[model samples]
Target chain A: MRVLITSGGTTERIDDVRGISNFATGSLGKITAEQFLQAGHEVFLLASETAILPEAAENLTIIHITTTDSLVKNMEKLVPEVDAVVHTMAVSDYQPVFMTALSNFSDDFSKDDLLHFSAEKVRKISSNSDFQLMLLKKTPKVISYIKKWNPQVQLFGFKLLAGVSEQELVDVAQKSLVKNQADFIIANDLENITKTQHEALLISFDRIVKMHTKLEIAQSILEKAQEAYHG
Target chain B: MRVLITSGGTTERIDDVRGISNFATGSLGKITAEQFLQAGHEVFLLASETAILPEAAENLTIIHITTTDSLVKNMEKLVPEVDAVVHTMAVSDYQPVFMTALSNFSDDFSKDDLLHFSAEKVRKISSNSDFQLMLLKKTPKVISYIKKWNPQVQLFGFKLLAGVSEQELVDVAQKSLVKNQADFIIANDLENITKTQHEALLISFDRIVKMHTKLEIAQSILEKAQEAYHG
Candidate 1:
């Protein structure tokens, strides 16, 4: 079966030289993809440029992407073809809108008084003035469209919260799962996670399974996905 | 002699998870540090978190840092203690100043209409608005302070320019050398660089040497620095 796994953090470029990225290393994604590959599945890993990649294999195909738009484009094209998709990538919530020079930044600073420029045109933005204004807009949700793209494909959506309570986390994840029509939601807490131990909840339609390690999480997803896919 | 090497690209944080970083991987810095260590010299490597680092050794000490302010603090503390310094880290030119929400973004968005907040005070920014305004300010030059911190330490400053003529590149490198009072300046062009090969010009008091590889650059810096120090 063909498996699609989006791993790592997406980058939002401020310019050609500089960009904003999250803390995701894609190691967990690597493990998930490897588990599927080991179980005789064809895995396609859509990874960030800075992500920790798994070893190259005959069955594993890697596609490197930077920005959110590229991710959306790839997802829209690849979701219908794959049998299952584990959306683990930390997609950026926002993209740069426009940049302008704030020459006289005060109570009277208005859009009419601003001179905005496209960040793409400038290779390296010069920080010559008192304040260089950068405007950002929300990016589209990549996971929400997975079921719409292919309703038959089994989907696992990841929800990471900084410091929310267990009930709050599960409720939010459940809402996300319903809205996206995903089969499973991996609810993760940032505070309890460390290098050696990962605190995550495998939330399904009726029950929530607690996972203590990254390997366990990968194994659970692999086992559960195949079981549901066949039966 | 104790040699100080600043390698890698510094990350400027917009928040806890998201940050801006450059393209420098610190491979050249790693090579340079390795060269100094092989010659039986004490090496202090001040590197960014995302930088490629040299292998561990008895004489090699690594210092990891992020942001311009942290880099400055490290530089001030280490520059006075070392005998020679090779400044190669791609320091961020700008830092985040303030972030404001642009609710009714149009031809008449004003500062008073803005609700500005500190990025550090918030966990994750909600992109539910039309536009989020991020203001940035110029970062202090760490190279400019090396000499002022310790006038006796020999300095080598790196100047990276994108798609400029050789003469233009050299002229800019010379200007930077004079401004920083660096003993040597390495001029680099963005267009002529590749993963396998690097194009660099080593400019000294009276002449310039062209280098085709990262090894050549490291060797040139090592030989030149030692010769000047002992002679």
Candidate 2:
């Protein structure tokens, strides 16, 4: 199978020195990619800056991504060919509409105030669009694009919640499934996810199964892919 | 207040190359620690061996931990003085029953003839109690120790669930509140955690509030801590 996976949290720069990113280390997407490779499937990976690189695979292609626009651009080209795409990266949902020209960035600033004239400052600077404080726009939901780009390709998306119960997860997962047209959504318990090792529940349309380890989850996904392919 | 927070999953070695771990990346614990520090609390952190560091804190002590025994040992000593203890690390619930002695690990050639070992020989070699599969004893519950060590100190714990509804989360959180005697339990959805960047909810005894960013969650925690301190 031609499997494509995205990992890591995209950073939206508030300024040159600071930005917004997610609380992630990129272990899931990295390991999931490796697991797919181990199962003898071709893999394509688009990684944000902060995600850890999984062990190199002989049949895997890696793409470095920094913004939602770039991601959309790459997916425009790659999503058509792959059999499955696992959308794991936390894309910055809000970004600045544009960036300042490089020349406007100062090496040394004057302590005293300088005269300013107001002219409309607008342009497409997708570079630092990930993090902006005041004038930000809701990013294109990548999953929406996947469904639009390739109707036949199997697409999976992730959802997270804090302090909701098991029944709440199923409701949310089901909603996400129908809303995004995802084949399956892996519902997780946050306490176990961020603190240490915990189990995960795979919620599909008809059934739910608990998997205790990442390997177990990956293997199940691989088997599901095989089923999807053979039929 | 002085505090200690542990984050991330510990790898329990089963052999030279294999070990057991979980999907957790240590974000929540780290975020909490950052919030506590932001509130001007002195913090000490015991972190699992992973690539990510604990959130930056001005008043913080960091201890790298590997085994369940070591975690208990460290806490037994430190739990006495801190005003609050947040045990967030996903310590392995089990460990290898035995360790193989290096001298006994011989790989001499035996392909030419049938490989055989007498029952007595096998028993003799395997009976070393220290090297015998070390049956893992469950680690002491951190809250139990906290309550025991300092009855007056405020205590908190988390209960995470997957594939459950919001009502289930509240039910689970309430049960945990009574059973664990926790001052508060931040019940949460896991599938929505590591990947979802913006949405988080907090469940206390009387209410559930959804927060849009990690910063807001930290702010809520700080407010709760202050309320507890003042009340």
iRMS per model, in Å, is 3.3, 27.0
Worst 10 residues of 2 chain A by lDDT: A110-119
* C-alpha lDDT of all candidate models, in order: 0.85, 0.62
The residue ranges of model 2 lying beyond 4 angstroms of the native Cα positions read A97-135, A194-196, B1-231
- Pairs clashing within candidate 1: none
The segments of candidate 1 whose C-alpha lies over 4 angstroms from its true place after superposition are A104-120, B104-120
DockQ each: 0.58, 0.01
lDDT of 1 by residue, A66-116 (tens): 888899899899999998999999998877775555654555655644445
* Collision count for each candidate, in order: 0, 30
Across B1-231, the per-residue lDDT of candidate 2 in tens digits comes to 877777775655433223334334667667878888877888878787552566565698888876666777787787777877666676554443332332232333121111121112221122122212111223345555666766655566665555468788788778767776677666665545645453556666687878766566657766776677678
The local lDDT score (0 to 100) that residue A132 gets in candidate 2 is 17
